[model samples]
Target: MQIHRGLLQQASDKGLISAQQVQPLWDFLRECEREQAHERPGFRATHILYYLGGMIAIGAMSLFMNLGWERFGGWGLFAIALAYGVLGLALTEYLLSRRQLRIPAGITACLVVVLTPLLVYGLQLGLGWWADKGHLSYRDYHTRVDWRWLLMELATLASGAVLLWRYRLPFLVMPVAVTLWYMSMDLTPFVFQDQDQSWALRKLVSLWFGLLIVLLAFWVDVRSSRRDEQRDYAFWLYLFGVMAFWCGLSLQQSDSELSKFFYLCINLALIAVGAMLSRRVFAVFGGLGTAFYLGHLAHEVFRDSLLFPLVLTLIGLGLVGLGIVWQRHEARISARLRGWLPEAVRELVERRG
Candidate 1:
């Protein structure tokens, strides 16, 4: 689906178009691709550096948060967060006012979303709502699974919504998805009555929450397709959705061989779903589950048997063969499948792709 400039030039040389027309046509096509969710943020060196810097900054604030940040006390933390958030918003406004910098603008808007939890944490400390022992650090927000983390997560989602309202930046949803994923785990205590909640119950909550997230992502994907928006509002949703679903599903206990086989089959179905939807997240999770299941079989069921390796090898070769066949007739196969789908479903797929 990628159009190389070389191919375009080759076509021009072959008299498909005059030499003067190629550059304009390439520019037009590139613009169209840029507007789609799957294609923007092209891999130029500058663009790569842009995302790398953005990710490092985001990680410093969220993932690798320093515990010393809590030492600033509630008011001091609030002041810092307020300063950073305001600065980020101001920069976002400036970037958006110009036509050439949507990516930077979106990243700046996302910083507002990232600062939500810090602001909420400050408020909690100032109001004496959080533990005063200073045992909870910003790092614990991600590492420790506790109900005390709910306030920050809630505030994050709210801020994400507000940012999306003001900016309509799809990258804002990444924080929303992260907060929701945390909520799925943190809400476990409230969902169950026992002080010592069972892992099974937790897994069930995760599985259901993941399924819900996936459904929401699919809805957003469809909506974005309908709207012709290229920002990819569903990317975070799909990423976290599969993480939750796959983890939950993998953690389940299957006592019988038939049940284990069923699990493997479901993973295979997930791989197929990935192809059908053209979503890599599905394939990544599905492939991981399949490999884990195979490993389980190798260690637990086929420990002394050599036959299993032979079977696995044959299965691998079969998959390679299948790939070859798919590559050779992908267009025909896609068209045939399209013929079988209902009108609405086909339209959605067309819009999404």
Candidate 2:
């Protein structure tokens, strides 16, 4: 314990960390070790074996079905199955390797290498399908509901959800789940057989779900904060899910005024929530909300008028001026407020500056 204390002191002296932050850093280190133990190769191997056995059992069952053995002899089907097995094994191994399970890094790479192209291809296919069906307008595409397509979509979403659960990959799962929900919207009309009712119901459900996710995320953040720990990036997953849910809600409402109002309310709520969380990113989001409000007012004044450019230019200048003034006056603001603030608050402000 003395040696540990000395090492911590040395670390603090080197500016590797502050004395106050050492406790949380030590706790995080212990947590990582615990997680690493769970992700050992032996445990991973057992998990892989179990999944492989299940896959084989399913494949064998499929082979016994009415679809003749000859049909399964095709190279494409065989290759696909082989690839699936190989990829599953690779993914399992990667997850089980303690040092390799860098959640943020892994997810960012996966999004770039996998999700981005997948989404692009899916969008192209969806567009082509719509075009072939003579649905030129976006609204027309929503009206045309195909049950078979919707079932396929649901199946795809289920498969993704299962994969996420099995691998315990929250980062990948969150985005995939959100994309699944978005794709699910295309199926809404088929379920209700009317765009208006279907979309309205979808929006209401989405709003509820969004609020739930956001609140859950905040709870998670607060829990972590209380422990003086870093929050997981998966918290952003909850945010994305909430955002996607709201996007669906926005699409459902055709009334431009109502949509704008709803969007403003949501942004304002985000700002409030972010402030409470003491998140810099969320504070930036709040700033964005303010900007959006300003833009909306400007839009109303300049709508279909020659004053549009002038209004935009004035807004831009005003924002730049405010930024400069803030930067210049920041020290004065800090000094003046320091005497009235608590010690903790003063320290926080000074550190931020």
Candidate 3:
């Protein structure tokens, strides 16, 4: 309130706004306060439900594993309980909608929190079963595949995809699902037997899914820009994740000269894309790429004298400095363009610019 008052006073003093403007601004602030108040209960309730739900699910699973069928029902009971919980949530949402009451944010939060752990547990059980059999190495199969593990992975991925699609948060789920699918293939020993085929499949899947995410993100950016809501930082983060996925795939094959070249080129491309999107994301992508480049250079120079490391350090610093200078140049150009016109004119210019 104090900050807002100060701002209003300054604006009034500068003749940028009239004293009458203060009342409207205050009303806006009050509306915002009301919305926050309305959201608070839902937020708190959702978090509490999340914790309680997770505990119940875990406890039930543990009991079933310990005393199957007699004292505890078994894994089937856990699945049934989860399904019931989901159905209950749906029913509650329907009731609330019919009553014209606001749908609580906590409900969504609770569902996400509860489901996350259950999904992980299912993944572990499936992986464990596979490992116990001859299909995978390691008794627990943390990094190896089992049939049960594949089923869990598929279920989790499908559920997440459905949730994302339902919520219209495709950017959030696309990278995650892509990553899970990639990791599943990596852990599956059957794929490694035919290394080239496996590698090609992974690359193809990643590229195909990555392009989808990229196109979706671009569409979002366009729509948000049109709606004058282009400040969404999540969109930029999603783009970075997409770029990271491609870069990660390249790194996995770094033993090959072609892969090493691809990694460097892709990192550069990511840096360019980030620079175009937003400064914060650009800096993040640049920092990551720089780190990888330095790591690779250091490895190559490890056997050489101190001169090699020093030279690489100098080159890396130069690249970072160059990026900073380029960013400053772009900022100056943007500022000049924006400042050259009045408010209405600026909006018109922005549309074209």
Q: Pick the candidate with the highest lDDT.
A: 1
TM-score of 1: 0.86
lDDT per residue as tens, model 2, 1-353? 22355677689999988999878777777788667654332346654664455445433423232324224333433344445445544655564574465443233323322223223223444445434534222222223344434433454455555555454444444545454454556556665575564556777756656566666565554444444333243355456655655555445544476667667786777665454345555445545656665577667744677777787789789979987997899778657867786665455444434
Q: Sort by TM-score, best first: what order?
A: 1, 3, 2
* Per-candidate alpha-carbon RMSD to the true structure: 3.3, 12.6, 8.3
lDDT of 2 at 280: 51
The CA lDDT of each predicted structure is 0.83, 0.51, 0.51
lDDT of 3 at 208: 54
What residue pairs are clashing in model 3? 46-106, 126-148, 126-149
Sort by lDDT, top down from the best:
1, 3, 2
Q: Look at candidate 1 and give me any clashing residue pairs.
A: none
TM-scores for all candidates?
A: 0.86, 0.45, 0.53
Positional deviation of residue 165's Cα in model 1 after best superposition, in angstroms: 2.2
lDDT of 3 by residue, 154-228 (tens): 555666555544543322343344435445455444545654445555565565555565655555555555554
Q: Where in model 3 is the C-alpha error above 4 Å?
A: 1-8, 23-75, 82-84, 87-247, 254-262, 279-286, 302-328, 331-353
Q: After superposition, how far is residue 68 of candidate 2 from its true place, in Å?
A: 26
Assess the local accuracy of residue 6 in candidate 3 as a C-alpha lDDT between 0 and 100: 78
